[model samples]
Target: MLCIGFDVGGTNARGCLMEFTDATAPPRQLAEVKERIRDTRAPSQVAAVMADIATRLVEQEGVDPAQIESAGVGIAGQLDKTGNTVVGAPNLGWTNVPFKSVLVESLAGAGFTPPVRIVNDLAANVWGEFCVGAARGHQDVLAVYVGTGVGGGVIAAGKLYGGHGGKAGEIGHSKVVPHGAPCGCGQRGCVEAYVGGRRLEERLTQDYRAGRSLGLRPYLPVELRDVDHMHMDAIIRPDVADAAAAAGELYADGLWSYVADLLAMAIANGAMVLNPGLILLGGGVLRNTKELSRRVVERIPSYILRAAADDIEIRFGELGDDAGVYGAALLARG
Candidate 1:
């Protein structure tokens, strides 16, 4: 059987075609395609881009569209209980959008129809890691991804736990400070407010404009020095990490270190509560900065309960950028 999976984000939508037999066996990737999202305001537009990516993958693989038995979408957003509607996606500027329906319509229009499963992107990532990546043998796992924003997913007792509202693993929104930095979610002091890539860029921009000397400023483009906000073309988390890494001693006391500390704190708090056997961290930030993971690991024991910290194995995700797509496809196959 064949399954199609998609990982849609604010910047791009990636889709993959995989062949799978059952849940026990791993899926084999046949083809993958990615499309940059030009317009994210409309759900239909993004759905269309995903549909096109799916179509292109099938074509690239020379597989019959009819061979696809199921489809899965890992999207960045808060989903309703049914998982059909995106309650809100701050990065995409979406509110109460029937994303699954729009995607289904778009796929149908593209001459493809398959039962689609919609899940939070982090959930898909965790599932991927659980099935075939770093957490392969772990029954209880917590997966956190720090990119444009921070997101988390949990697998408890060998099953995905969605909680009463199907939003169980939103560790990003966990409050870190009272009345601190503002988050895109319209809240204050969220872990994401301090560590998310977008938030970090915003903070850097603010600090630069305020005449605060930053180690990262020299590494940034000259034009960004006078900019009010860091645009897409400006320096990102990976660039910032590189700059910090280059400045040996500064890496320890720089903004990236603070970001790592807060993220570690959030992860520790989550570990104390969930007590998962494995804690897998990934996403653009962790992937780009290897030192951040070590820093986070070093701080975990201090913040987490001793018992919880003792048994937990913290590691970076193995699947890199393809975790979501692989997980989504396997989940759809099941």
Candidate 2:
């Protein structure tokens, strides 16, 4: 069966087409595409963007829209029990919106009326990793994805731990600083405010301007290299790493250390609560900042009880950005 999965975020919708045979067998990827939304913050606009992508994929791949058996949608927000209404998505400016219905309506013209399975973006990312990527073979896992904003997911007893209202892994909203940076979630000092790619970049620029000279001026954005918020790679990848790979290593050490500590604090608290079998790390932040990843991994063991943390294994996401798309597709198919 041919199925589609979409990992919808604040700025982009990453989708993949896959062929499914059996649950244990690896599905074949038929096609993949990333569509940027002009007005991702608007729910209607996001739906239109998804429609555009779906229509294009079906047309380009020459796949009959009617033949598409299922579709998976991973949203980066709080989802209701039905997984249809988005309770809150500050980044997407969505509240109490029936996202699946809107997207389905938009795709009506394409004749793709297959069932859409919706899950949280972070949850999909974790689930994808747990199923076929880094956290595979682990019955219990904790996944932390740090990108534009920080968020997490959990797999307990071999199932997604969505908790009440399907909002179990709202770890980004976990308070890390006291009266610190403001978050889009209307909270202060949340983990994302301190460690997420966007806010972290802002803080880094401020810190760099205040403390030291720009030793790596060429690597920074003309406006501190974070002008484009659509892609984390555009701002955080080569720019952050290239800048910090050299002299800026000394200059940026403090910022990376700060991010590492915040992540450790949040993850350690999760460890204490769940004591998951495997701790999975994902998102562009880890891909862009190797040293930061190392620092975070190094610190996790020290933060939790030795017995709990000792056997816990931390691994980077092997599937990159596409993890959630596959997860959604698989979920839809499964």
Each prediction's TM-score versus the true structure: 0.86, 0.86
Worst 10 residues of 2 by lDDT: 229-238
Regions of model 1 farther than 4 Å from truth: 21-26, 208-211, 214-257
Residue 241 Cα positional deviation in candidate 2, in Å, after optimal superposition = 6.9
lDDT of 2 at 177: 88
> By TM-score, who's the top model here?
1
lDDT of 1 by residue, 1-334 (tens): 7889898887788888888665544678888888888466578888888888888988898887777888988888878989889998777888899888898999899878888888888888899888878888899998888887888999999888889999998899999899988897799999999988787766655664454635556566776655554333454445555555546636334766777788889999999888999988888876776666677778877898776678888888888877888787766666
Q: What's model 2's lDDT at 267?
A: 90
lDDT of 2 at 253: 66
> Which pairs clash inside model 1?
none
Candidate 2 positional error at 117, Å: 1.4
